[model samples]
Each structure stands twice: as structure tokens, then as C-alpha cells.
Target: MTEKEKMLAGLPYQAWDDELVILRENAKLLCHQFNHLAPNETAKRHTILSNLLNIKGQFHIEANFFCDYGENIYVGDNFYSNHNLVILDVCQVSFGNNVMLGPNVMIATASHPLDPVARRATEFGKPISIGNDVWIGGNVSVLAGVSIGDNSVIGAGSVVTKDITGNGVYAGNPCKFIKSI
Candidate 1:
């Protein structure tokens, strides 16, 4: 059987790396489109905010929200979410002050398996947190086990998979701290 099939069968597996890579690629594609899509507004803000989902703070959407299960998400003051924002929030996703999310940005708190025999279908999640004054560029994906520090700037098309402590600029897959901001 294929590795994906084995994982989906719900067998025991250690699945942090393999799932993370696939998830990053998928999320990157989604965010890429989200960043470029135009907002559907007639008179006022035609933002996408689902009632069946949970959202905090005075929501200001300069775009659309394709959120999946919005129960575990929170936004802080002066928050600005640009077009094509998708959040797969299975666990807590907290964003701090003056957080600016560019187009097609996604914050996902989900995971799967690594072992080919145990990677097909199993799923899990971790928490994500963005500190104050964080500016995330368009097409950025913040993965499950990530916590960005205050005053950090995530460049466009970057994928963050680990905790960022110092304030700085980060970009690329498996986002690395580029420079102090």
C-alpha cells in the first residue's frame, strides 16, 4: 500500500515533517490566489464573514475570508485583513495589535502524518499566535506549530512552520528570520 493510504488508514505514525510539507504547498497555492482576487463589494464592505464561525475584535476585512471552522480564531485591535484570507483554525489562532494581513494569507493550525504507512488520512492540530505589530505579506502561510514575535514582518509567499522569537523579517518556505525589523 502507498504511504498516503497507510496514513489515512489510521495506523500509528510519527507525522510532523511529511504532512507539514504537503500542507505548506497546498496552503501556498490557496493563498496565492487569495492575494490576487478582487473583493466583491457593491456599496460597502462585501467581506466574507461566516455566521457559523467564531471571530473576535472589530472585524475589518479589506477582502474575503474563506475560513474553515472559525471557532478557534481571534483578532486584535487595528487589524486589517486583505483580500483572500483563509484560515483553517482547528486550534487557537491569535493575532495581536496592528496586524496587517496581505492578500491570500492563510494561518493554518492543522497537521497530519509522516510515515508513509500512517500518512494518508490522520489529522491533528496545533496553536498559532502572532504578536503585536506583525505585518504578514500577501500569500503567506503560517503553519500549525508557529508563534511569531512582536513587530515581525513575514514577506510574501513565505511559509512559517516554527516559532519566531525575535522581531524581524522572514521569508521563504520554512521561513527564516531575514533581518531585524
Candidate 2:
């Protein structure tokens, strides 16, 4: 299978493969262009994002947004992400409509093998999915293979390690449900 196919399938693959490297380079270039635009260049910024990610409908993403393989990330309508948002989209990372992410939030789909020998040779990835009407607080880290259910709120400085299936407020490191929202 191709490197991209391996990545999407959550199988081990060389991240530095020529094809993957090229895709990352192109995404970096587009992100650079989007990040350096004038404040008034809204139309151009949208155009750049149009070329970079699968952004559907409307979104107001702040500057300094970083991602790997932007094409693997998808954002639905009415999305708003604060500054310094990073998405490591080695696999697919999808955010549903009305999703909002606070500053310094990271959604990472990339993962390294625990085996030292295997880690150097190949990397794998898992998908991250955020349901509609979700709000992820500042400094939160959403790890690989996680899904936050609809209308849930992730408190600031939290690290999400597992899937949250029910709607509620979650907080703390390795975030746990605080209370139902």
C-alpha cells in the first residue's frame, strides 16, 4: 500500500517517504501564505484555506494554525479556532459544524510506536473526530483515535486520552468527565 494509504489505515509507514514529504511541504507553504496575510485579506485567506484543507462552509480560524498534511483535516461549517491551534493530521481529523477550539489547542492524529526499534522505522496514525457544537478549551490536547461527543466541553489544560462518548464537561490531565452539560 502507498504511504498515505498506510497512514490512513493506521498501519506502520515511513513518514519521510517522498510522496508524504512533498505533501507536507506543500501544506507548509500554503500555511505560511495564510499566516502571513494582511488582516484585511479575508478573501485571500479563505482562498488559501480552500486550497489547503477540506474546510466546508464558514470558518474564522486565527493565525498560527499549524497542521501536517492539511488535506487530511476537515472542518465543517461555523467553525472557529483561536490562535496557536495545531492539528497533526497524519490521518484524518474531522471537526463537525459549530465546533470551537480555544487558543493553544492541539488535535493530534500522529503516533509513534512504543518499541524503540520499530519507532525509528515506521509511524502510525489514528483519526480524531469532534462532533458538532463542541467546545475545546485552551491548552487542551486531544490525542490520537479520540472522539468527543456532540455538545461536550473540554476544560482548559486538559489532555484527552480516550474517547468521550456522552455529552458533558471534561477537565484535568487525561481528562475525565466533570459533570453533564
Candidate 3:
């Protein structure tokens, strides 16, 4: 299998492979263009995002948005994200409909090997799934392989490292359930 195939399959693969590098570069360039556009240039921004990600229906993302391999990221209908949203989508990072993200939210699907020797040689990633009607507060970091179920609210400044079931309020580092909504 090709390096990209391996990467998508959650298998270890050389991140610096030519194909991967080119894809990342393209995504970066598009992100740069998207980020630098005038605030009132809604049509242009929509055009760029349409080319970059797999977005469904209505969506709006504020400035300073960045991602790796935009094709691996997907956002559903009625999605909105505040400024400085960074998604390191080495593998699939999918969002369900009616999701909102606060400023400085980082959703990452990329990870390195624990073994030092193997870490330097190859990188791997797992997928992240966010269910519908979820609201993630500011400065939240959702790590790889996490799933946040529908109708949940993640409090500000939380670091989510595990799956969160739906219809609850969760907060704090390593995000624990607070109360059912």
C-alpha cells in the first residue's frame, strides 16, 4: 500500500513522503489564502473552503484556520467555528451537523509512536468523530481517536482524551462528565 493509504488506514507511515508533502503544502497554501482574505469576502472564503474540505451544507469558520491534509477533514451541515481553529487531520476528522467550536479549538487526529526510534521514522493517526449538536468551548483540545457524542457540551479549557457519551456536560483535563444535560 502507498504511504497515504497506510496513513489513512491508521498504520505507521513515513510522513515526509513526496505525495504527503505535496498534499500538505497544497492544504497550507489554501489555508493561507483563506485566512488572509478580507473579512467581508464571504463568497471568496466559501469558494476556498469548498475546494479545501469536504463540507456539507452551511458552514462558517473564522480567520486563522489551519489544517493538514484538508481532504481528510469533513464538516457537516450548520457548522461554525470561531477563530484560530486548528485541525491536524492526518486521518479522518469528521464533524456531525450543527456543531459549534469556540476560539482556539484544536482537533487533532495525528500522533507519534511511543518508541523513540520508531517515532522518528514513522507517524500514525487515528480518526476523530464528533456527533451532532455538540458545542466545544474555547481552548479545548480533542486528541486522536476520541468520539464526542451528540448534544454534548464541553466546557472551556478542557483536554479531551477519551470518548464522551451524548447528552452531558463534560469539563477539565482528561475531560470527565459533569452532569447529564
TM-score of each: 0.69, 0.98, 0.99
Estimate, for each residue in 99-153, the C-alpha lDDT of model 3 and write its tens digit.
9999999999999999999998999999999999999999999999999999999
The lDDT of model 2 is 0.92
User: Which 10 consecutive residues of model 2 have the lowest summed lDDT?
Assistant: 164-173
Question: lDDT of each model, Cα atoms only?
Answer: 0.69, 0.92, 0.97
* CA lDDT, candidate 1, residue 59: 56
Top candidate by TM-score:
3
Compute the lDDT of residue 31 as modeled in candidate 2.
89
lDDT of 2 by residue, 1-181 (tens): 8988999999999999999999999999988998999878999988998889998899988888888889999999999999998999999999999999999999999999999999989999999999999999999999999999998999999999999875799999989999997
Judging by lDDT against the true structure, name the best candidate.
3
Model 2, 25: alpha-carbon shift in Å?
Answer: 0.1
Candidate structures ordered by TM-score, highest first: 3, 2, 1
Q: Per lDDT, what order, best first?
A: 3, 2, 1
Which of candidates 1 and 3 reaches a greater lDDT? Answer: 3
